[model samples]
Target: MKKKLLLVLSILLNSYLLSAQIFTVNNIQYNVISTNEVEIITYLGSDTNIEIPNTAESNNITYQVVKIKNGAFYQKGLTSASIPSSIVTIESGAFSSNQLTSVFISNGVLTIGSDAFSNNSLTSISLPNSITFIGDSAFANNVITNIDIPDNVISLGKYAFVSNLLETVVLGANLENIGESAFNNNSISEIVIPNKVTTIKKNAFSSNSIENITIGSGVTNIEEGAFLYNPVVNVTSLSTTPANLPLSAFDNNFNISLTIPENTSEVYANAGWVDFGSVNGETLELETFIIDEIEYSIINLGLRHVEIENYYGSSIDLVLPSEVVHEGSTYKITEIGDLVFKNKNLSSVILPNNLTRIGYDSFSHNNLLTITIPDNVYTIDSYAFKDNQLISVNLSSKVNYIGNEAFSENVLTNVLIPNDVKIIGNAAFYDNSIRTLTIGSSVQKIGSYAFHSNKITNVTIPDNVITISNLAFYGNKIKNLIIGNGLKTIGVSAFNNNLLRTVIIPENVKSIEYFAFDNNPVSEVFCKSSKPFLYNDLFANKNNIDLTIPADSYYAYNDSYWIGFKSITDGTDLIDTTINQIPGLLLISNHGTISNNLQEYVSLKIYNTKGQQVLNNNLNGIYIVVANDSLGNMVVKKMYVQ
Candidate 1:
């Protein structure tokens, strides 16, 4: 405990100031990446069990251990180790040649460096979905029986899993490059490569236990000797043309049947398909058709629904069929594939009711003016409608997520975020012209830059919102804001550059970050916190603003930050709170009486032929009611006779 607790002090000493220093806990040294932020750099303990904490404390400073640096845990002897979610990278040879039978890598890790876990004794390992790259020889010579790469991963580096005892390997959906000899000596029997992969480098799977393989439609190249040695019996390629490959790609693989998509057998026959034993074509429930000179591929989602695969159109108003017929199958379009309209000159498009999911960047950089998202859509992936000239969008009420930059840089003037959304991703509404936004009661968090640089004038944040992240409403001309009570935190610069005159903060707030309301001409702040909360330069006072707090909690905001206000008080009443709004006009009440608007009359002045005060609140019948509002707008009305 001495080693661990003392390091906490080291973190707090400089972490907050963006300062850093190395520290040791339990003889394991950590390099301070920031204050209370660290990366495991050396393992000095002689223990057999290793547990890396998500948080490390030294001197009251809580450090997030975010990385395991290169060669940090390269030494052997320990049999088990666990890395926490705070970690992001496992550097080259970080845990090479370990005797561990178990290692848990959390989803926060983005890269497993070259030879990071080679020659490990682990029988099973789970790489979380956050992984993007498995570097050269990363997990080679391991005894793991199976592996499932996450869909976000892009590259499997050269010899990544060479000589492993892997019998099952599921390639991720987004993987683009299988580097040279990535799985050169694995025992994988068969593999279905996802369609997104673009290249299988030379000798990528040479000398494997593979007997069959299915190459998806997206692959464009098969380098020499990609399948040099295993006794491959059947090969299925969905590409309409033969992948760019050398004659030696399958030179040694004899007695193999090469199967191509229907109508593609002749295309591959002339491009080294004969190197295999035979070539044949199979119709696998997928077809390409020309719609307005654009090539489209469709596949059945069910007996009735279909999904659009690709769009190779140049410039047109694409009208996807509500129902398309292919191979005697009547299919209702249900989804639009990722990047379906990316970088295209699609002027307009219509979606069918059966459509549900709009994939990432589906309509990004398009010239669409208005589009109707059908009711059934539940997910609007990141960048789905980004950078469009869309002035109108009819979003489905059922959409649960407005992804990062979903409608950013659009011409939308207003948006009513539906009730089902739980999270508003970062920069979700950046640079939009939305003057009015209605957040449904179900929204919990407004992410950073979610509404920055908007023209919103007034808003009432629903009571359900708990967090408003950094720069959420910065650069807005917000004049009237009614903050909710459920809020816990206001991130740095959350509402900077607004035109607020006064704000009554909720009582449940606990934290306020740096410059949360800076760059504004705020006149007053009514704080309700009984216990003082952490504060920063929240005020850029252009005029005197009364810092009002509860009488019993005067000391709560009696700090340096609060002292910077023009004046401080605990008074709630007698403060100007009305705005000069458009007059609703005088109307006779249903009760045959008129309610008076005396918001401006702090007190009454009377005159009876000689400037004499007369009959204030003591009048009986028909005395004239005269008063000015908080904005000094004078009014006169005849009172009712009781």
Candidate 2:
């Protein structure tokens, strides 16, 4: 009898706490957990548009309204709602039966409960980066045009986006599961599952208009009807072994075309993949060849052309083959495809003598120390050698394009751009240690952020480039910069945050954007253009910049925004912004002398007043010496050399 009474008391206490947590404030009912924590349980007012406050005052206590409970806004007269960042969870059926056309999820939301936005009229929704779990039927029956799953999402619940009119679906990099009917009845055209996905549950992507799909290597299972009712035309698998694809997984779509890796054809063909239309691997007959004990997969573009896709086995110096023989047929290897040697610890690579092109990310994120591009190559695709320890690279004269971020984040000290290059793509050499760069004469443009945050001390842009895009040299240690005459525009923040002391703007430069030299220590400008276009804040923070204009146009510089500088002078005594702004005259002994402050050796020369060199020699106390280097940074001493 005593035990039964205690149980009944426990139940009654829970009931009392539940009642105490529920309260009404301004005709709106909320559920309170603590004195300072609450959730919107239901709306008692008749407001059509609601701006949910991040925090509220309740009975002299400040409460954070963190959640919208189940059925809180059901059948409400709400047309729009502004969720605050403090709200982390949207409970089941929270916004159902509302005439909502647009809903914004704030940045701190972590979970969307089951059916949270189901049956709503949302046309577009941007899932915040903090979203991790999307519950069942969370966004079903919407008109979402495109969806980009954030990288933090790990799982999609069953029927998550069912019946949506989604035209595009971009999967995140960390998604691991596709729950039952997750994307059913959509209009998605293509999908490339992230490399970490391990499963596709029942009918996950069914009833879609998907034309192509790429299954990542980590996928181990495709449950029955996972892709049912989709007219998938092509499938590509990055797996070396045949994955378990049940006959009903594809709904036995007989019109599918599948492409597996070179050696997995037989395993895929025997696993019911041959039933699909035109298995290319079964008929094309891939051939492998050995080069210095390393094996490579060569795809015959025809009898005369070939591509080396994947190479196995590593040597300190990898030497590719010029010709590959397979099945008694000879094909000349011509190109390297995407990610051909990515993530490898290769120290060096020797291209074939007849190689013509290297594709995207071909040698990215490797341990290569040096590379010599063949003379016949025409293109170096994006991310070709990014995130490496590469110290040296020799480009071929025939190359025309250096793609985006081609050699980013490397330790390269110098680069000699080939004379045939026409375009330098965005972020081509960002965050590198390239102290010396030689832009070729044939280049037409330097893309955005092309040399951002580099160690370059001096550079000379050739006359062929017409534009230097925004932030091209935003954060560098550059001391000297020479713009060519063919340039038409200098983009926004192009030369911000440098150690520049002088600038020479060519006569053909038509426009310069704001913050082009925001934080530079510019003292003089030799501008040749009489009335070149200049914008506000061109020299944002540094007020000591001096603009030296052409003799013919003093009014143009003194009247417009160019007058904001520290001073304006004539271009007749124009200054050159060389790194050797400070005189480096020093005293060195006749004996062997190392730098007293880790300085590099400067040139020792004696020159006559007519620009004629009288003597140039090593450090000796025999003659008065002058100094200059390639970067115009010299460590000179007034020592006589014998």
Candidate 3:
């Protein structure tokens, strides 16, 4: 009985050994995990292109190949590999030390062990979304240029993807940790860490060309030398609490600007975060955050409003987000900070709807061809859109201020200053190709060189303008000019170098400085001022100009400057009876009959209160009539239209 029991035990042990023994099928080695399941152990075939079979025939039974064992294809001269969908695991050194340039990982793969595909020449690799774990040195020593980690990946092992040629890296949203030297020695310029990653091991991103980095909110600890030998310029941290980082983490690169959450500068400073370059809250006077690559600052906490601070992206056409959410609070973007998008080479940009102000040099030095200022924008600061390629600009109706050189050096063909603007800054529209310009009715001052070097043909200084600074409209092709009634001072060379043939100075003019109207071929001058305060060489060809003054005002023009004109005329018969009129200008009856005593006028135009020309001259409202004569003489009068 004892011998028979011993024989049964020996036979059972032999049967178990046969079922689990290593076997070969089609020059491929395999080990049986069960009666119906097997794992690939080694490849004995001498082929450069490898296709591992999903099933193996052993002992007249078929078994499914589900995993690649350790060192299965190590040191094999493989050029390409096609992994089967049934493969769930690839153990350590499965395909290491090969010359693989192409690899197709199937969707069923869940894990890649240490050095699985290391020491290869792969230029690119597509990681399947099914992968959850990547062991140490899995894909190191490759030539890949870019990488998009699978969203399902949770663990990235040490030395993974090291010594590659990566330019851009997009971390997976669910990744929990970054191992030591994970992405060392790459060419990555920009990287956005997902919110789930909490740990960054030592030398994780060392020796990379990273310029901009955005750390997620979940990151708590960064090991020493994690970012060693990197020239990082801009860093955005979403973590409200400062992360623990050694001074050697960035390897003496303490000049990187840091942007953090609102009102957290004190904590960051205590944590040595201020030891780096300027902190946004402390230096920039505002707490900043980044959303979708655009940096924004919290301007008003109670109102939840933000201002765009900077843009760290490489897109030619950009559309700014209207609002952003940070730390469970929503903030409406209402302004653009100084130098936000300067020199970005942008072709087009769409401003946010709620944006109310544009800061200095906001969009300067770009390739923008057209821009439409939003209706809510109230201010455009100095050099806001200077040195661009703009062909057309639509000013906001609510704009109240335009700074110096705001639209300078552009190719603008037409510009309409909205009615609310009060002042035009010096050189505001200088060096532009403007052909038509409309000064708003509320403008009180025109700064020096405001409209210089434009192709403007006509100019009508509205009734509210009080001062025209030096060189205000110089170097323009202006043929007709009508001064407004409330003008007090005309600065030096204000209208010099224009193609003016006729000039009409209003009654309220107090002073006309030297060269105020120089370099103009003025054949007719109509001045309604009864007592001209002071004057200099105001006109280039004053000896050939015909001066027309009020009928009883000839006594005031007896001075040497006024007598320099070729002729002075004062005829009382040209005056209107019902109105305090200038001689030889116009006569308007209560029934809106506009007739001038002089028959030299060739063309007549009528404009309403909003500066729009009307066809019918017979209307019962206060209107402005502009008449031009054959001799290039012009008369502008306010009359009743019926």
Candidate 4:
């Protein structure tokens, strides 16, 4: 009897534990553990006020109320309600189309689904700091006047707040990025995007009545259409110092004055000109932007007074005021701006005593017969002395940089470059009549077309020159070339149309750039060392010419490649005698045709004055008919009738 009693007690305890919080109405037991919360499933009547209980239980079994599913309370009567802290999530359309005056999102909730509060009567909202995300169209079509986003929210989905009656938008400091159309078509008059929020998505504020925007400084790139159709005016002055104004940053807007700060120099494509007027007068004042630690003044426009500080004129033998100081320290203007004297007719100019820099086009098109550039001058800007009748130019020892077209079209027979110059700009000496070129050893880069189309007959490139740009010596009458050992890159068309019969590229040359020696009459090439000199069409097709590459570089040659003639040194054992044999007698007929005269049974060898056989073959003697002047009369000679 005792064992049966213990078993009954155990069974009773198990049944009691299983029926915890079970509901019973009129003694009818109903399981409440699995029943969903009483979601205002569909409001039968337009009740003014509504409430949802935490639990609906008839028997003793409790369930956890987690969410209000979508459309649960569509068109409900409640003007506003505070969601209980136990609610963790709200599904899409849960409270949509309701007369919800406002929503108090408690801290326990994690998500608000799409259209959850859409088409509601909420005037504004302050999201709980614990909410992480709001889905698309969650608060769209609502009467929310302003929104204070939660600090913990990471992103806002597209159309999340579209058509809301918003006056100001305060983004969360912890927000990383915003999605497209997050706040479209709102009455957002002012917004302060935090520096931590790096991006503003496209169409985020489009068609809004946004009249003012203050972009933060930390943003790098403004993406396409970020602020499209905004009513903001005078955007440049919005920030004390705006950063990274990209191209079209201010497009499709109107502004009065654009004041580029002293710290800002680069104005990217069309960013500051939103239908701006042509030639807006400016008074630029920059400070402490010193190169080589020399302070200079840009402009000192007096207040409310238009001062034409400097005049650019076309005068002969013009002398600038000694008070003008540009670029560096000593009050002598060192540099001039672009097109300062582009088409002037200055014959002989004596620079001001303290003047240092000659700006771009300072003395271009001047028929200057002679000029003595002072030693204090350093930089000669582009086209400074171009298209002049300069028979001689004495550059100062302190001059370092010679700009492009500096001495082009001059009549200088010879020029001595000092060791201080490190670079020569493009077309610096083009069209000059200099017969000899002596580049300084300190010069490293020769710019494009530097000495092109000149009467230079010989050149000894300095060992320090590493790069020779394209067309450097094109159309030159150079008969001798002494390329330096340190030369590495020879640019395209460097020696085009030259009369060079032989060229010796030094062993230190690594790469010969494209078309470096094209259209030149270079008959022979001798590379000093076995290190390969890459020659692709270096000697393209002078059929009657000879090329003698290094003995070890014979493996780099192609038989069918049209390097027409070869003269390899005897030191190269790689030469196969059969392939090295000359074809036949090179009959130099008056018509310039190469042929052979041969008797099939007889073998003959023909050699020129250099002890190299021109033709060696067994053939019948061939006759190439040639017409020449014999005793002042036209005569035909069968010269090679062997």
Predicted model with the maximum TM-score: 3
Q: What is the per-residue lDDT of model 4 for residues 219-298, given as tens digits with 9 covering 90 to 100?
A: 44455556553445434333333444433333232222343334433442234322221112342233323322223333
Which pairs of residues collide in candidate 3?
619-641, 619-642, 620-641, 620-642
Task: Sort the candidates on TM-score, descending order.
Answer: 3, 1, 2, 4
lDDT on C-alpha atoms for all candidate structures: 0.72, 0.74, 0.81, 0.60
lDDT of 3 by residue, 1-642 (tens): 999999999998877986678889877899988768899989987566788878888778888899999999997666689999889999999998776789999899999999999877677999999999999999987668888899999989999998666898988999999999999766789889899999999989976767788999999888998886565778898989868767667633234778889888788766656444467733445578988889988865656888887899999899988889999998998889789899999999999889888877999999999998999987787799999999999999989778789999999989999998866877999999899989999886788899999999998899877678889889999998888886656889999999998898876565678998999989988887554444588988987888888765443455324766776777444323234333454454455656554432336777888999986545778888887754455668787767
| Candidate 3 CA-lDDT value | 0.81
Question: How far in Å is the alpha carbon of 214 misplaced in model 4?
Answer: 21
Residues forming the 10-long window of minimal summed lDDT in candidate 4: 300-309
Ranking by lDDT: 3, 2, 1, 4
Off by over 4 Å in 3: 1-285, 572-642
Question: Against the true structure, what is every candidate's RMSD?
Answer: 23.4, 25.6, 34.8, 30.4
lDDT string, candidate 2, 32-53, tens digits: 7665778999988666567787
Higher lDDT: candidate 1 or 3? 3
On lDDT, the leading prediction is 3
